[model samples]
Target: MSHPALAFSEAEYRVRISRAREQLVARGMDALLCFAQESHYYLTGYDGGGYVFFQCLVLTAEEKPLTLLCRRPDVSQARDTSLIDEIRIWLNAEDTDPANQLRGILSDLGFAGGRVGIELDTYGLTGKNHAAIQAAMDGFCTLVDGSDIVSSLRLVKSETELDYIRKAAALADDAYDSALDTARAGVVDAEVTAAIMTTTLRGGGDVSPAGPLVNSGSRAIYGRGVGGPRPLDAQDLLILEYAGTFRRYNCCIERSISIGGPTEAQRKLHGLVRETLEEMQTAFRPGDTLGTVDDIHRRRLDAAGHAEHRFAACGYSLGATYRPSWMDVPPMIYSGNPLVLEPGMVFFPHVMVGDPETRLAMGLGNTVLVTETGCEVMSRHSLDLPVR
Candidate 1:
């Protein structure tokens, strides 16, 4: 049978795997059991929605073949998308113990008494499954948290990955245009959302993990609001935060639109947001610490007298992701984070300001790549609030 088309070449995956193996060896780990779908895809080109169930990819330092422990339903998925030749299926019976099955697989692969790395902080591994695995591996192997081992490798983007991200960014710009065109007086929030989705999909964008949040009126005050059936009024504020994906690589954009001419207060907030985003671009140069960029944002907001309206984190890493959230990796733009900026790292710096008392929300943000000198904004949408 033919294998599914891979997003990257076999050489690229080999480099990724080599980096991961090096990290594992440095940490004294003999093998890595990855539960996160991102890690699976990054390592073996496996792409599927079956990660909601229990699935794991076992990567060993030794020349033994890589193995995948997945449910029967994902067997074809693994065969089709992954380069892994050894696949094991676990039955979902009430009395069946898949953890023990996994333990057996490890033992058969000569990892019975080795230091095995496991992704302990992922949703892919539930509490029940973790407990079962721990019980099964007791005295047989030593399990250690290796979540950052693979995740840290994904922080920097390759040129091929950046090309996909650029395509996703173009789609995000189109989605923003659609949102602006659909968001007007008397239009229902759902209609606007449908338009955004249509534009995104029609433009060859993949499904995003988070949202195309189309919050209007008071709901806009909440940062995490979603689209609803409510119709927009003649004088309403609409906050739109959405993303576009290409081969699971995501580029997100957030902008606020005014149904009518924006009020003076709305304009002020929008202006401040725009200014903060511009400052962020200047602050995102290589060699700068994540904390320094965050400090710049906070200082600018405080200087503008909008400290009370600032968001907790100005931005976070972005990349190929599965459900739960689109945010990726570490170094979230927050105070005290010591992660230094590096080239090839992509992030979305969103300048969000909301006043609950006034029920006003205004935001402007864009996906950016940290470059040798400064940064390059991926999404090309205007920073100014679009007045519909």
Candidate 2:
């Protein structure tokens, strides 16, 4: 199906609602109130303005009609397409509080001072919005951190969700191809970055998680930023990582290409990361917990003589929309969280452990999905180091 046509279909919305209801019961909650962008998209098909405009969904545990709150600008879309219990609008100024609007809706929906589970992890209720919500509740509502429940609900990926992710991966792969086709001696960092961005847009990509990591050489290897640019030398490492959004689903990937000849150290280190990643892929069974997989990555890194390097920046959850802003996490870096590997959980496994002393960044990641037997690597670009 064409992306534009299937991006927001009603048929897909039912799948999300059904999945969320299962999670709601498991969390032992009466309702799942999602004010975060990613959560909203996961539950309902409201990806308008992503998390910026503050669209929200309130899913009851009983599978009753869901409540949807939208900004005035998005009210029409919510009414037309959403399977919401009651649709309401909350007018929000740049710095004004949106409390009364929030409270009034919750109050009208009978969510008074009870166990109102909410996904308020990322500053959703911390500023003027918090104050408004607090005042509106008037000690009637008890807001609790809902990340655990929300994460549990979204742990497994749906086939439709995978389709969006695959589309995103294809777009990012295009950026990688574009970067290689145009890379050469003396190209500036900005030029390379621009090429990736333009190529992504032309290939039908939307906004990525944090834009393209167009850093080359040393910059590209690290998990944080791109490498330094000195144009492309002969066989120089051209590290490229980027993703484009289709609807709110994001597909991200990173690949390295040598301009002329690959250095022995670069080849060795890149291979090490790849080999280690492959090992992790081998152990990624459907029943393994995220915590266990994280250990597997760290142990592999330590065994490879990266014990001194902290395995801190190596994972992200890939799903409905590009994290709705960087807070969406990769699943491997969990701590005691027992989220099981399912048939459709997509994770951005970015295995990295870089030290500043060497100024060399070496890591690899591709949005992967867990299947019934094992996991599948969505990215196919080869990051082969040089024979030299």
Candidate 3:
């Protein structure tokens, strides 16, 4: 059989798996039942989303081959994309419980009565499946929440991973430039989204896991991308938040466009957001806590009387992530989160300000890479709000 094509090399996968096993041993775990698809992809290069069903990768603390328990459909996905060779299939039946099947695999791997770690913090492991796993492994092995084991290791990127992020960043810059050019009076908001997506894909990037969030007029103040796109008003405010993804790695950019000549208030808001983003970038220093960066965002916005208009989090970590989000979070830039800033850690710091009462919004952001002394802002676009 032909070998599966992996994003990273086999040696890299081996290093990651070895490091994960080391983490397992350090955590006093005999085995780790991986649930997060990111974890599987990171450690074994298993890139399938069968995790939406009941897929799991079982890794032992010892030097044993990795095993993946998934449905029949993912058998090829695992074989074709990952270094994992031991593929176990669980059949679909009205009475089938894959968690029990998982227990049998554990027993076969000599994990009976051993201390096991389960990643309980992912969308991959739903509550129903958690209960089933709990019931199946009850008295068989002690389960501990070791969700951060792999995620912590993944926070610091390798040079190869950073290469992908840099490429993604270039694509994101193109998408922003394309959106700037495509957006105009009477243009539909979806058209702007299309420009962004097209720029990303044509530049060899994958579709962003979440949104190339494009909203206009009253929707500019919304924190999230709402369904349905509408035409731009003669004079409008458009908010754009998007990522360029390469091999699932992401680099994000968020900005607001003034569709026509900006009002005094809109220009003021844009100035404030741009200033806040600049200040936040200046604070992106290694050894500083992620919260410290957010503190600058809050202090500047709150002092400017836009406290209610700002998001609680100014930004978050960015990386190779799956659907539902481009933000690789848990280390979100919020007040009092003490995750220390480290070199090679990538972040998207956005300064977003909006007033629902006035229906005005302004946002300016960029992806940055933490360095030894400070950080490097990845976006090539100017901080000035673009007026179309």
Candidate 4:
């Protein structure tokens, strides 16, 4: 059979699989059942939207080859993108038990009655599916939560990954510029969103799993509001949140703009957000803990008397992500998180503040990569709020 196109060389995949095996052995797990799309792609170069359904990559420390179990429709997808040659198909029939099939593969691979690792916290593994898998493998093996094993390994990116992230960041900057230019009095919110999307795609950005967020006036107060038909008016505040992707790797940015000019109050809020973002950049270093960076931002905002406006988490890891969100795993920048800032770790430090009483909102953020000395702001855009 003819092999499908692959993103990385076969040797790269081999190295990744070898590293995963080492992690499994260290965890005393005979095998790893990866259900997250990011994990499957990281290990096998498999990229598909079929993760909304049930699919898993079974990697074992044994001499046997890895197995990818997916629905029939995604077979070609797996063949096209991944280095996985051993493909197992589960039927769509109601009576068909994919979990049982998974058990058979595990038993065949000599993992029966052994400890197996599963990504229990991922969105790919549904609650019903988890229960079914447990029932199917009841006496055959022991299941342990190894969600962080592969994800942690993915934290530090290689040069190739960094290159893709940089490309994506460039696209994000273009999108931001488009949004700023398109946002003006008498313009519809949807129009601004369209400009951002068009510019991103025209600049070689990949299709995002989630569309860009554009909201104005009252809707702008909510951070995650989607675009609507509301038209911008003079002095209206507009919030834009979007991402750019290259080969599924995402670099996200968020910014706020005023239709005409900002009021003195809005200027104060924007200045506070700008200062917090500056502090975020300065505090992001290899030795600094994730919580330390978050604390720096939080303290600055609290001292500015905008503590109540801040979000629960200031930032999160970013990488190759699918629909619903572009956020990657672990090292959430929040208070009390002990995860250290490591070199090559990319994240988004988003500073947002909203006042319901004043009906004003301001946000400024960019994708940054933690470096040995400090952090590199991947997205190149103005820190000041743009008045269109």
lDDT of each: 0.86, 0.66, 0.90, 0.86
Candidate 1 scores a C-alpha RMSD against the true structure in Å of 1.3
TM-score of each candidate? 0.97, 0.84, 0.98, 0.97
Give the winner by TM-score: 3
1-388: candidate 3 lDDT, tens digit per residue: 4454789888898899889889999989999999999999899888877989998999999987789999999998899988886999999999988999999999999999899999998878999999999999999999999999999989989999999999999999999889989999999999999999999999999988898789888888887899997999999989899999999999998888888889998888888888889989998889998898889999999999989999999898888889888889767889898988999999999988878898878888899999999999998888877789
Model 2 worst lDDT run, 10 consecutive residues: 1-10
Off by over 4 Å in 4: 1-4
lDDT of 2: 0.66
What's model 1's lDDT at 66?
Answer: 82
Which rank order by TM-score, best down to worst? 3, 1, 4, 2
Better of 1 and 2 by lDDT: 1
Top lDDT: which candidate number?
3
Task: List, residue by residue over 1-388, the lDDT tens digit for candidate 2.
Answer: 1233235566666766776677667766667668766666566555555345555677777757677777777766655544555776666667644556666666766767666677666534346555566566677787766766666667676676778778878877777766776777566666767878887778776766566666555565455554444666555566656665666677777666666666677677888888777776665678887766667677777887887765654576776644335435635454455767777887776666565677565657677788889888887776554221
What ranges in model 1 sit over 4 Å off?
A: 1-4
Worst 10 residues of 4 by lDDT: 1-10
Off by over 4 Å in 3: 1-4
Q: Please, what are the lDDT tens digits per residue for candidate 4 over residues 1-388?
A: 4445666667777888898899888889999999999888888888887778879899887647879999999988898888786999998886999999999999888887899999987889999999999999999999999998889888988888899899999998888877877888999999988897899789877887678878788887787856348989987888888889888899989988888899898898898889888888787899878887788778988888877877878988998888778888676889888888889999998898877776778888888999989999997787877788
